[model samples]
Target: MATADTMLQTALREPARRLTLDLRAVTFFDSAAIHAVVRVAERFPGTLAVLPSRQVRRVLEISGLASQDWFDPS
Candidate 1:
């Protein structure tokens, strides 16, 4: 989770209109990971696109974060 947070922070430092996070390879995540994702989404709004794995998707759904426009299941 610390590594993920560091990576996300490093990525967000750059300027981009859209940031697509391919999380299909991520099989597990905790609240800290979810918090980081939400922070990015809040900071960038529609600019964050998430390709979540089944587990990640479930976390988002349970947390109600899946309803956000930035969470793209496709």
Candidate 2:
């Protein structure tokens, strides 16, 4: 997940408007991963779209980061 985070950090440098999280390949994710994503979102004024599978979505929903606030509609 840290590797994904690093790539995300770098991706944020571009002119993209949203961050799509493909959590299909992710076998597991911890609080640290959630925190890292939140921190990264804070770095940007826009939003972050966490496009996790049903399984991963459950984790994010339980972790309290499962709102549109994290998803960029713009």
Each model's TM-score, in the order given? 0.89, 0.62
Q: Please give, for residues 1-74, the per-residue lDDT of candidate 2 as tens digits.
A: 65756755675676766666566666777776676667767765565666566666667778766774764222
lDDT of 1 by residue, 1-74 (tens): 86678857866797888888888999888888888887888778878899999999999999998999988887
The positional error of residue 36 in candidate 2, measured at the CA in angstroms, is 1.2
Overlapping backbone residue pairs in candidate 2 total 1
**What's the CA RMSD for each of the models?**
1.2, 3.6
Off by over 4 Å in 2: 1-15, 71-74
